[model samples]
Target chain A: MIGIAAPLGYAAYLSFFQDRMIGGNVFVGFDNYRRALGDELFRAGLWRVLLFLLVQVPVMLGLALVAALAVDSGRLRKPGLFRIGIFVPYAVPAVVASLMWGYLYGDRFGLVGQIGDLLHVDMPDFLGSSWMLASIGNVVTWEYVGYNMLILYAALRTVPHELYEAAEMDGAGEFRKAWSIKLPAVRSALVLATVFSIIGTFQLFNEPNVMQSLAPGVISTSYTPNMYAYNLAFNGQQFNYSAAVAVVLGGVTAIVAYAVQIRSMRKEQGK
Target chain B: MSVNTPARRRPRRASNALTIAMGLMLLYALLPLIWLFMSSTKDSASLTSGFGLWFGHGFHLFDNIGDVLSYDDGIYLRWFGNTLLYAVVGAGGAAFLSTAAGYGLAKYRFRGRTALSAVVLGAIAIPGTALAVPTYLLFSKVGIVDTPWAVLLPSLVSPFGVYLMRVYAAEAVPDSMLEAARIDGSGEVRTFFTISLRLLAPGFVTVLLFALVATWNNYFLPLIVLSNPKWFPLTVGLNQWNSLATGAAGSGATTTNFYPLVITGSLLAIVPLVVAFLFLQRFWQSGLAAGSVKE
Candidate 1:
């Protein structure tokens, strides 16, 4: 009962009157929800995060899968070195990584600036309004591809030798083997990585928050839902509304993640 | 084995192409780091002189390091020390607590085991940032704001660590061993610490590394909790510097090189993490493989 009650009680407490509980206000049934849906910033934040999810998740996961498969192939002589190199960024604190990239993206004193001068061409401003999202995506991809790769690579290693041997015996090419055997074998891991990525995409904070200094005009307070919620709670002092936004964002993530899981499970059953 | 020798030759060509592509990918991964290294050596004047990646005439690496360390009465060192304390204590405590909690969940068929597991899974899915506001409010109500305890407490309850420990404990610790220990008159604590804990070494290391990295890199929690710069972690400290630099840039301050200090500080911040990775990479790789599904 303690085990069950501890978590459930926390959830109930948070969901029931999280706003009033935090701010000592009267209960407003679904008014917070209505406010969240009506807020243009909230809607824009959701759309921006969803767009990020659509583009970044696939590219990041694909790169991770490719790197993992490459490292697992045993063809690379120094796979450990490459693995460690790729994984190094995961260790660097996100704020610091953002600063580093911020400098690299700097117009005047950055590497890009220096290279542009050398080539006698104008360097495209990475932190410009049109490119800020993609710039942030680049940083995210750099930080996480190696991490997801490690997971998928670990999963790849668990594929039985007999399966590969059988594939080879049937004159299956490497691509065919990867598609028919390797991909199917690591399906669960791919799903796990994708789900993890989706959750992570919504939780985007440190990168944009840090990069905000570099591109103030580009990244608004509502660049992502997390940032928007943060600004609302702290800057706007609207804790009740912020909590409402958080609840809605959390609900969206949970629903989408659950749907993905259910759909994948159904596909597996069909197979 | 020799069934596809000709096809194998074709794969060799494909493998060569793969290796080249992987090499390029590795270089891409290292480019920003290389840029950081190069930029740290240059003076302020040369910072924008179209030689950012190349070595400048003024080799002020030591000067920059000195400046970063000495800034604000050696506040960077204080931040560094606070970060170390947080990482060591917070992650250490988290690993032990999660291990115990995971052992309880995995080894015992308790009344609400499934419910507990589900709660943990849900917690794992809930982003840490999502809880930051509530956590801050709770801590403030208790008047623990700006205290290390605020950061330390939240760091202790990593739901992902708990989940990983549970999965690892299930895989690494045998049920029969627990029964045998019980039959041999061992206490539950003794069985856990002596037999189960020892067996779970790899998993423990994995959890320790994960927790350490998470706590060490943690910015938002510390950012929200600690208003005092003295209590800041490297992430917050560097960000404060970045913000100050932006202000300086706005004022058009033609001063001695703040650029080098930022670069050098960034480099120093990365060193400990790099060292941790190098020292723990072997254990991490093996632990990851072992703690996951077996081949």
Candidate 2:
């Protein structure tokens, strides 16, 4: 409990105060929160992550669902190999994944550049200002898609085979069986993964931070809210403001994750 | 046998299509690792000049590994050792605590069980990085900043691991077993350590590996907490090398690019994990179901 609560509680406590050179960490009483709410960098980072969540989560989870359904349908050969092959990336640390993708995303010396030159085709700079969001999305999607697939796949395996036979007797084809039977079975798993992804999206730090070097100007210190708060405390020495940003980010993440949880619970009950 | 009728025959053909599609997903997943492996074989120059997807000029993988190990007074080896220490100790402690707490939560009657479980579940949703700055502040106040404890303390608690253990313990450890142990004069703590823990072994290893992956991959906590290079884990140390290379490219710094070393180091970092996954994935499948299998 100390591990879970102390820092967060301290963070909440620290958020209300600002350090002044004259007075030395005086209680500012909502000033920092006001500033954090109005801060352009934090707001932009917030919106950017929202955009990333919208574009990336569905694509990644949708693909995971498809992969899980395909394997669970008992149609795939070497399902074990297929399953583990996909999950191998999840085992790769986010920092390593970012560095790997950062190297691959490099325009001058990266794989795409070399491939483009070999094919006589111009490759757009993947880690450029406009593309960095999607580039980071690609890295995150690669890492978690298989992990989520495993979760859904686990749920699928637990589903009674009797359910499938019943669906078959009802004349359901593969698609219909998946829709009517397999999908409902994994509904809770899907929500769990979605909530995890929601939390992950809000905590987007490693990818953009590690990739910042490769795309210096393209990826800023405030590329994500977590990164923004990081830069504030570590780089700018604004611990109070940073604490406020973090608390707000944590609050926002909890709200969304809680909402997803509640909605999934309601759906389960409604069924 | 009844299901293996003519109706299943059509889906067999459709299964062929599913096999091909899953094959693509496997390729998509494996491509980057393939790229990482192939890239590690090349020296810095060939990395850019040679084919990106295939073997680059001379196979300098061993040579690059040597360079990565020997560079800057063999700091990569230090970082590797540090990573191993952090992962082993941090993940090991987290697994034990999570299992103990989860077992207690599962078996023993306690006040506010619902509230405690809800809090644990709620804690899982909080983004870890969001706690970094505040954690730094808290640790600094206690003068633990820049120490291993700063990294280890935060990593030692995983709410998800606890949740996994709770669910697994509920299913894996029968209440009757506990009662039998108690009747046999085993105290609660002794009973847990002796009987319940043995039954929860698979779940224990599962959470252990999960915590292992988590601490191994952890970046933000250590980034804020540890300023000294000696304490830096592999992730932070590798990024430092990467930045040295990227920093040089970005500006006219005298930072000579450590491109080969960084790539080789990255390849080296993930090797243990990939091996672990390959070996444990079948066993790990049982653990994944523990969550969904819960009431």
Candidate 3:
């Protein structure tokens, strides 16, 4: 109880006060929040992450769903090997993954540079401003698809063998069975994965933060809300404002995730 | 017999198309690790001059590993040791607390069980930033900000672990078994430790692995709390090396060849967790089935 409530309350309390140069710390009421609302970089970062969440979550979850279904279908040879192989990335820390991908994305010295030179074609800059978000999305997807796949596949394992037998008896092919029987059976697991992905997307710090060195101009201090809060507190020393940004970001994430959970629960009930 | 044979044969026959698709996915996942391994074997000069997907002229893996271990007064080894200590203590504490709290919530007739579970579930949605900033402030006030306790304490409170254990315990530990233990005059705590815990082994290991990975992979909390290089985990330490290698931390730092060390360090960092995942796959799958699918 103290673990969750105390810190949140403290942050909320701290958000109401601001530290000043001459007057020391002062109670600023809603001034910090107003400032965060008007901050262009904060808003831009918020919008960027919202965009990231929309595109990345679905792509990652879709890939995870497909991978899970493929493995669970018993149509893939050495499914265990494939499953474990895919899951190995989840064990790799985000810092390491970002460094590895950052190096690979290096056009001058990395894999793409060599490949472009070999093929005599100009390679797209993976770390450029135009492609940075997508590149990060790809890294996030790579790191998580297997983890989500494990959840869906585990859920699939619980579906009785008799369900598939019954479906087969009705002359339903693999696709038909997957579409009707398997999908519904794993719906809750899918929802769980979706919620987790949504949370993960909002907390997208490690990749961009680690890669910031490689692409200095592309990623700003306010590239994501978490990054913004981090830089505000650590770099800018605006603890009050950082707290407000964090509270606002956390509030939005909680509301969206709660809405998803409630909507899914209602849909399950309506069925 | 004919119908059964066709039905069985159909599902068992591996589809060439599916195999190909899965193989592609496998490649997508493994290629980066392959690249990391391949790049780790190259010296700093060869890393940039040579192709990333293949090896360099010489087998320099040991040389790079040696540099990583011996560089900068062997700070990489210090970081590794710090990471091991943090992960072991943080994850071990988290698993134990989750097990005990989850068992209580599951087995006992508590006053606010519904409310408690709801709060725990809701806690999962609370962003790390929400907790981290305030926790840092509070810890600083208490003067534990730079200590390992700052990271360890926060990590021990895994709301998801509690939820998983609650769900697992509800199904795994039978009421009849508890009643029999009670009838035999065993204390509630003793029965829990002796009987229920044995039944919860798979679920415990599952939670342990989850907490283990979370702690080992944690960057944000430690980043905020610990300022001492002596206390930095592999994630932060490796990123520091990366920043230095890329010249992002500004000039005037020694440790000239950090690129190979970073790559080699990254490779070494993931080895233990990968091995753990391979060995504990079955427990994780079954434990998750009980926790998630049953719910």
lDDT string for model 1 (B1-295, tens) is: 3564443222332367777898888887888888888878877777667466678877878877888899889998998999999999999998898889988898999798998889887776666555666666777888999999988987788777777788888888999889999999999998988889998888788889989999889988898788888799988988878877776336655444556777788888888878988888778887776544331
* Per-chain TM-score, chain A, candidate 2: 0.97
Candidate 2 residue-wise lDDT, B1-295, digit = tens: 2455553324443367778878988988998889888888988778777766789878999998999989989888998888898999999999999999998888888899988998898888887866788788888989999989888888889899899999998889988888898889999889888788899988888899989999999888888899999989999999988878867344557343478888889999999988987888766788878775464
In terms of docking quality, model 2 is: medium
For residues A213-257, what per-residue lDDT tens digits would candidate 3 score against the true structure?
Answer: 989999998999999999999888888889999999999998899
Ranking by TM-score: 3, 2, 1
The parts of candidate 3 lying over 4 Å away from their true place are B1-3, B6-11, B252-256
Stretches off by above 4 angstroms in model 1 are A1-24, A116-122, B1-14, B248-256, B290-295
Model 3 steric clash pairs = none
Give the lDDT ranking, best first. 3, 2, 1
lDDT of 3 at B14: 79
Q: Count the backbone clashes (under 3 Å) in each candidate.
A: 0, 0, 0
Where is model 3 chain A poorest over a 10-residue stretch in terms of lDDT? A106-115
Q: Which candidate is the best by lDDT?
A: 3
What is every candidate's C-alpha DockQ against the true complex, given to 2 decimals?
Answer: 0.48, 0.65, 0.69
- My TM-score estimates for the predictions, one after another, are 0.93, 0.96, 0.97
Q: By the TM-score metric, which is better: model 1 or model 2?
A: 2
